[model samples]
Target chain A: MRTLILLTTLLIGACSAGPQPIRYGEDACNYCKMTIVDQQHSAEAVTLKGKVYKFDAIECLVHYVSPLDETTFSHLLVANYDNPGVLIDAKTSSYLISPNLPSPMGAFLNAFDDANRSSAVQREMSGELHNWQSLKRTITTRNQIPN
Target chain B: MSRGLSLILFFFLVSISTSVGNKLHVGQDKPYATIHSALAAATAGDQIIVHSGVYRECPVHINKSITLTGYGMPVLDAEGEKEGFIIEADSVTLEGFEIRNTGFSYIEDRAGIRVKRKHISSFRTTDYITLFFGIYLEHAKSGIVRNNALHGKPLGEANSGNSIHLWYCADIDIEGNLIRGHRDGIYFEFATECRIRQNISEGNLRYGLHFMFSNDDIYTGNTFRDNGAGVAVMFSRRIHMLNNLFHLNWGQAAYGLLLKEIYDAEIRENIFQKNTIGIFTEGSNRINYVDNDFLNNGWAVKVAGGCEKNKFHWK
Candidate 1:
């Protein structure tokens, strides 16, 4: 259930994030707002100007991105929620998965651009070391969690 | 005051009464050939009596107030091709009829009966009641649809439909009915001031009762069993639910009741058994959850943040 909530949050963030950074609510960050990276409300945003903003949690990005008009955006970008500085398109970002993550929000990085980097991250997180398709299949099937 | 004057007055009264045009008998000299034909010629305050048979036809459109009753059980079939009945009229009563085989379309929302009321500013805009719904009311006021059975089989989400669907209606009374095997047993939206009582809703693919953006509706003494989810109340205010039973609604993402963005409501004395969650309340506020029994559910209540001042009594 907790994992589901986190996926729902991520889905919301993904849907709301667009090309231009929308000023969401009282805070900054079009996708998510992050005063810092390690906190609960950290988020990430990608603007139309090819600049990407990273936050501590998904909620910060949602505050701005959720209310933005869907037609006004040009591109979507997100820092691999796991590996900062390695940015990727939100649609193509395969590593951030829904279920079977160590985090409370149930988001985990499954693969990186480099196979060695992915293997290292998998070892650190004690993951099953699945490929991208396997990871997506696992996340999609994880609709329910043991309470 | 004399006998001669009294006799004249009696004749005058009889003449006036004959011109009132109230009673219409079916199977008489001008007996209505079909239910649709009789409905076409009838006026307000008139009665239409039908003989027993199956009428495999399209939806009959009614726009005047009248009472339509069947002598024996009369059947109206959409042939699973078209919608069943549409009532744009007010004060309509349909009794002793079986409506079946409504058209299934994922794109169009169709049902057995559809009622549409006049706007608020229209002349003679009075509230009505839908006592039973093998009856659907849309944008109608004060509809009373009662004492009927609605049955349909749903293949999937795309092919499923609601047995009774009301949109933008108010002051509804749904009572004493058996509704089963549809997508939603009942669906209401943007409606208010309604009461659903003493009904059995089962085997639906979605919810037994689902409504959104509606307020001040009371649901009591209804049985919802073997549905995908028992009930869902969303974006509504000031509603009250009492004495209903939600049972055997168990699946992934299923719950006895799902509440979202609701305010100032009361949920009391309902029984929830064997559901994924007895009640899942998210973004709900100021709700009084009183004396409800939750038996063998995955969770009695799963509450999220943004819920405040919700009181749960002993159960």
Candidate 2:
């Protein structure tokens, strides 16, 4: 029983070891090269090779991952907009796009782990609520207009 | 004489008589049907002249050191495709064309013209739709990009790109271009020893000119107006900013010129007018600000903490 418990603990620790904490005002975004100033709209991604990529905004993270195969990444983490520096699973998080809530990159998209919190913000902010896939699709579609 | 001897003599004579460079033509009624075909047929030091017409095609990749000149501003429309032109060879020149519709991609830094060690001039880019970059230079050295007009859609920063973007380049010259309505009009990252002069950058979503980690650069006689922020020089050294105009850049978080983590720079003979902040400095050292006009700004100059050995003088 002790051996089984040790194995379980090891597995949990390995799984929980994901992205690192983003250093605000120092670390630059991998996509836009802007300094990561706001923690609320920030994101971090860990590749399979254990490379960490930080983003100043959720839109920057989405744009960086849009052209790649999503399965290659080990973890996609986003910071809670209300609680700074707290990361949640990006795949399971809910997002709201509202002009009232300004982001560092001006996309105005914020992430929330709880659906009820997202809905509450949506009611207050009056913008569209979306899951990860839908939000990615929306950004992709919006950027694909012919010039 | 034998037939083989006669054929050999004819070939030798032709080789001796042919010139070093040839001029190829491409248009609706020209010899070649498409620019790609003309480029394929051209050799080094040759010239390809394209007449005026609208063409819908893939990105024209130039791998040879040739001059591709267009007459009457022929339009190369990508039509939501990837890119308009990709010049990979050194000493190549692309001039006088209307390059349009380089569609945006999340994965790729799409551009109307992507060059490495080339000279680009006399072109126009129209942003009927949103796109990434207008002219993107990567790892290019001693190149020239001048006399271009780039028009971008006035999208937010999340969706838009820059008008001229340079990455890891050095000793390039950018002059006499008119750029508008992108994330940043001119963006440089890890670029060194470049010269930017006499260009007009306006209505950008971000700063008109954004510099990051670039050193030994000089910008003179440029105009940056009505952008989200006028200009930002960060993490750099030995920069010279002279005789430029920064005007009407107003926002809650904006400045006519922002200097951060910079050293050994000269900011002189510039005009800053009607901006949210005329000049904002942070963590900079050993800089000279002389003979610069600050007219009707929210704050003329805001010096943050950690700055040292900076001198400011009025005209």
Candidate 3:
């Protein structure tokens, strides 16, 4: 009984779900078929079954998840534009579409986990700010490649 | 009359000087201390010879029509900070140099050697390492990128670049290049009328030769081995694939040659050996698969839906 309990606990611990680090040069983006090299603008999505999908840019994450059911994914994370390689929650994050900041897949989108910090950057860079749904609508409406 | 005579004399002297092709030498012991100084002093139709040394510089922009040749294989190291050379002018011939370490950038697509304008050019580079893109050709036409060897050791989870990247270019020749350990060995997007021949592209992290939206291209006599995925030609038209070898590309979703949304391609006399899928086609139309050998692949030809009028000539 003790061995069974220990084995179940170990299996559950082994299968624990979280965001894996985006290997910049190694991992390929699941959406746009690019190598996920950008640290500041990449993103990740975790399904309810614990399957992780990585993207090279924030817009790719939005475009990929836009048509899917909302209940499919348990967590959606975007890279903090201020902090390179740091993944933050996508639902609560604020987005800034600044032409001054270019991304890997050419969406001109930047994400910040903090709203106040995103607004401050917007003040400095002088672009539009958006929430999750607005950003998704804007990204899906327009084409992906701008150049 | 005297003023006209003097002006004619000046023009005669300038023409004679330029036609003679002055040679500027750059070395530690030569007249010029740096290649930049030599380039600044050089005019059009001049030849600048760079001697053997490791020179750390970013963006050695060549704006004049000149021949920049290296003696004894000089090294231009960017130190993972910036690009190596940005060739702007036409009729530029760059030969015999080792360019390495064009550092990674998130905002910009940096390269070891970037051919910007890309008309009537010749680039013969030796080796490159740890770069985002090895040789990038943008808006270029009628150029030859030949006999270059690029070896990349990519950083952890950082975005890796392609070895030879061509964007919106046309009528270029990519020949005899040995590329390994990149995202894609040769990548072409919106490029047209190009020829990729006699190149060995192996062990890349993505497709060995990945081209999209290119038309009227010819790829022949190349060896693509052990790449993450093999060659992928998507959204292209009137391409010719002849006498190439695709071997040992194995993964769950990998293929020897993947064709998606392609139209009117002639694929002839190629060999695909030991891959997960030999030829995976989707939405391809009017393609002729003639004399292609599939040896020991998981699936010889896995046809997805929406393919039309593909003639398979079995030899």
Interface RMSD over true interface Cα atoms for each candidate: 18.7, 12.6, 5.4
Task: Report the CA-based lDDT of candidate 3 relative to the real structure.
Answer: 0.85
Every model's DockQ, to 2 decimals? 0.03, 0.03, 0.27
Please write out the lDDT profile of model 1 over residues A1-147, one tens digit for every residue. 999999999877776644443222112232211112222223455554444555433323333455565334355344453453344554444343323342212244333445566566556555554443454455445432111
Model 3 lDDT tens row, A1-147: 999999999888766777788766557677755556568889999987778999988988998999999788888999998788889999999999997676655567999988899899889888899999999999999843212
lDDT of 2 by residue, B1-315 (tens): 699999999999888668656999999878998998998899887889989898788588888888888888888888876788888887777888887778766435689888865343322222222256899988788888888888886443445677899887888889898998887899987789899999999988777998877889999999999887789987788999999999998876678998877889999999999998999888899999999998999999999888999999875
- Report clash pairs, candidate 3: A23-B157, A24-B157, A24-B158, A24-B159, A25-B157, A25-B158, A37-B158, A37-B159
Task: Pick the TM-score winner.
Answer: 3
TM-score of each: 0.63, 0.67, 0.79
Model 1 chain B: weakest 10-residue lDDT segment is B121-130
Candidate 1 structure quality by residue, lDDT tens digits, B1-315: 699999999999999877655766665344677766777777776878767777776678767777777677767777766766676766777677667666654224566667776532111211111122345666777666676667666543324556777776877788887888766788877678888999899987667998766788999999999877789886688889999999998876577998877889999989999998899888889999998998999998999878999998875
Off by over 4 Å in 3: A1-42, A48-60, A81-84, A92-131, A141-147, B1-20, B105-109, B118-132, B157-159, B213-215, B235-239, B260-264, B283-286, B305-309
Considering just the first chain, candidate 1 attains a TM-score of: 0.38
Weakest lDDT window of 10 consecutive positions for candidate 3 chain B: B121-130
**Deviating ranges (above 4 Å) for candidate 1:** A1-147, B1-22, B27-30, B119-134
| Clashing residue pairs found in predicted model 2 | A147-B129
Scored by lDDT, the top model is 3
By the lDDT metric, which is better: model 1 or model 3? 3
Candidates 1 and 2 compared: the better one by lDDT is 2
The 10-residue segment of model 1 chain A with minimum total lDDT is: A32-41
Give the winner by DockQ: 3
